[model samples]
Target: MLFDTHVHLNARQFFEDRDAVIQRAFDAGVSYMVVVGFDRETIPLAIEIAEQNETIYAAVGWHPVDAVDMTAEDLDWVEELAAHPKVVAIGEMGLDYHWDKSPKAIQKEVFRKQIRLAKKVNMPITIHNREATSDIIEILQQEDAKEVGGIMHCYNDAVDYVQACLDMNFYISLGGPVTFKNATMPKEVAASVPLDRLLVETDAPFLAPHPNRGKRNEPAYVKLVAEKIAELREMAFEEISEITTENAFTLFGIKRS
Candidate 1:
C-alpha cells in the first residue's frame, strides 16, 4: 500500500470527478492520502473531504502565495481549523518567491506566524519553499520549528538545505519533479536522503511525473513517483513502498491498519 503524503484534492481542478479520482487511487493501491489546503477558502473543504473518506486526512494552513490578502481574522480562523480532529498538520505554508502573487514581507510574516501556530498546537508542518529557501530556513530556525517536526513538500533545495531540515527532524518529500530528467537537485536529494527519512508524493493537480509530465496529476500517479525513487536509490519497488509509506505514517501520526 502507498500513502500519498501531499496532495490537493480539494482544489477546484478535481471538483468534477473528485470521487472517481479518489476511487481510482484506491484501486491503484494508494491506501491513504493527505489533502492540503493552501488558503482559508479551501481549509474547510479539505476537512470535509477527509471526513467523508476514511483513507483521507487533512492539513490546514495558509500558503505563502495567499498571505497578501490575509487579515487577523483569517489567522484566527486558520488556528481554529488546525484544531479539527482530521487536521494532521499545519501547512503547505512557507515562502514562495516564484510568483509575485503576494508581497515578500507579508509572506514572511504569515509563514512565521503559521510556524508559531504549529508549535502552539503541537502539530507538524508541511512546508512549501520556492526560490525563497534562505528566508524560509532563517524563519524556520528563528521560530524553532524543530519542536513539532514536519515534511518539506515538493522539495527543490540543495543538499545543505535538505540537511538543515533533516537536522530539524523534518522528512524530505520528493514528488514528480524528482523524476524529471533536468531536475538534478531533486535527483541528488532522492539518492542521498536516508530511506527512513524519505517520503513520496504526487502533489496532485500539478508537477506530474516524467511519463505523465504536463498532465493533471492525481494520487493514482504516486506509484510512478515511488518507482522513480526505487530506481534512484537502487532499491526494489516493494522496499520503496514499505519504507516511504512508513515514513508518511510516522510524519503524519497515522496508524496503518
Candidate 2:
C-alpha cells in the first residue's frame, strides 16, 4: 500500500475528473493521501474532499506566494479552519523565492504566524521551501518549529539543508523530481536520509516522474517514485513502500487500515 504524503487534489486542474482520479489512486494501492491547501480558497475545498473520502486528509495554510495580500483576518480564518476534524496539518507553507510572488519579509512573517498556529493547535506543518533555504531555516529555527514537527514537501534542497530539517525533526519527502535524470541532489538526499525520517509523495498533477515526465501527474504515479527510491537505496520495492508509508503515517499520526 502507498500513502501519498503531500498532494493538491483541490487544484482546479482536477475538477474535471477528480472523483475518477481518486478512485484510480485507490485501485492502484494508494491507501491514503494528505491533500494540501495553499490559500483560503482551497482550504474549504480540501476539507470538503476529506470529509467525503475516508482515505483523504487535509493540510491547510497560506502559501508563501499567496502571503503577499493576506491580512490579519486571513490569519484568523486559517486558525479557525485548522480546527476542522479532517485537517491533519497546518501547511504547504514556507518560503518560495523562485516565483517572488510575495516579498521575502511578508513571506517570512506569514510563515512564522502559521508555525505559531500549528503550535497552538498541536498539529504538524507541511512546509514548501524553494530557493530560499537560509531564510526558511532561519525562520523555522526562530519559531521553534520542532514542537510541531512536519514534512518538507517536494523537497529539492542540498544535503546540508536536508540535514538541518532532519535535525529539527522534519520528515524529508521526495517527489517526482527524484526520478529526473539530472536530479542529483534529491537523489543524494533520498539515499542519505534515515529510513525513519523519509516519506514519499507525488505532489500530483505536477512533478510527474521519468517516463511519465511532461505529463499530468496523479496519486497512482507515486509508485514510480517508490520505484526510483528503491533503485537509489538498493532496497526492494515492497521495503521502500512499506517504510515510507509507515514514516508518513508516523508523521501525520494517521493509522493505516
Candidate 3:
C-alpha cells in the first residue's frame, strides 16, 4: 500500500472523471491520499471529497499567494474546520517567493498564523516552499514548529537543507519531480534522505512522473514515483511503499486497515 500525501483532487482537470481517477488510485495501491486545498474555492471541495471517500483525507489552508486577501476570520474558520474527522493537517501553506503574488510580509504573517494554528490544534502541517528555503527554514525554527512537525511537500531544495528540515522534525516528501529523468536535486535528496522519513506524492493534476511528464498527473501514477525511488535507493519497491506509508501515518496520525 502507498500514501499519496499530497494531491489537488479539487482541481478542474479531474472534473470529468474524478471518481474514476480515485478508483484508479485505489487499484494502483494508493491506500490513502491527502487532498490538499490551496485556496479559497478548493478548501471546501477538498473536505467534500474526503467526506465521500474512505481513502481520501483533507488538508485545508490558504496558499501564500493568497495571503493578502486572507482574513483573521478565515483563520478562525480553518481552525474550526480542523476539528473535522477527515481533516488531517493545516497547510499547503508556506512562502512562495517564485510568484511573488503576495507581499513577503503578508505571506510570512499568514504562514506563521497557520503554523500556530496547527500547533494549537496539535496537528502537523504540510509546508509548500518555493524558492524560499532559507526563510522557510528560519521561520520554522523561529516558530518552534517541531512541536507538531509535518511534511515538506514536494521538496526540491539544497541537499544540506534536508538535515535542517529533519532537525525541525519534518519529513521530506517527493512528488512527480523525483521521477523526472533530469531532475538532479530530487534524485540526490531521494538517495540521501532517511527512508523512514521519506514520503511520495503525485501532486495530482500537476507534475506527472517521467513518461507522463507534461500531462495531467493523478494518484494512480504515484507508483512510478515509488518505483523510481526504489531504483535510486536500490531497495525493493514494496519496502519503499511500506516505509513511506508508515511515514505518512506517523506524520498525519492516521490509521489504515
Which candidate number would show the highest TM-score if scored against the true structure?
3
Candidate 2: segments with Cα more than 4 A from true spot: none
Predicted candidate 1 versus true structure: per-residue lDDT over 1-257, tens digit per residue: 89999999998999999999999999989999999987767888999999999879999888898899878888788889877778899998998898999999999999988899899889999999999888887888889999998999999789878888888889999999998999999999999998889999999999999899999999999999999989988999889999999998888888787
Model 3 lDDT tens row, 30-137: 989999997778999999999999878999998998899899888998999899999999998999998867999999999999999999999999999998999999
Ranking by lDDT: 3, 1, 2
118-228: candidate 2 lDDT, tens digit per residue:
999999989998888898888888899998889988889888788789888899999999999999999999899999999999998999999899988999999999999
Candidate 1 Cα RMSD after full superposition onto the native fold (Å): 1.0
Give the worst 10-residue stretch by lDDT in candidate 3. 248-257
* lDDT of prediction 1: 0.90
Residue 188 lDDT (model 1): 93
TM-score against truth, every candidate: 0.98, 0.97, 0.98
- Candidate 1's clash total is 0
Candidate 3, overall lDDT?
0.93
Candidate 3 Cα misplacement greater than 4 A, ranges: none
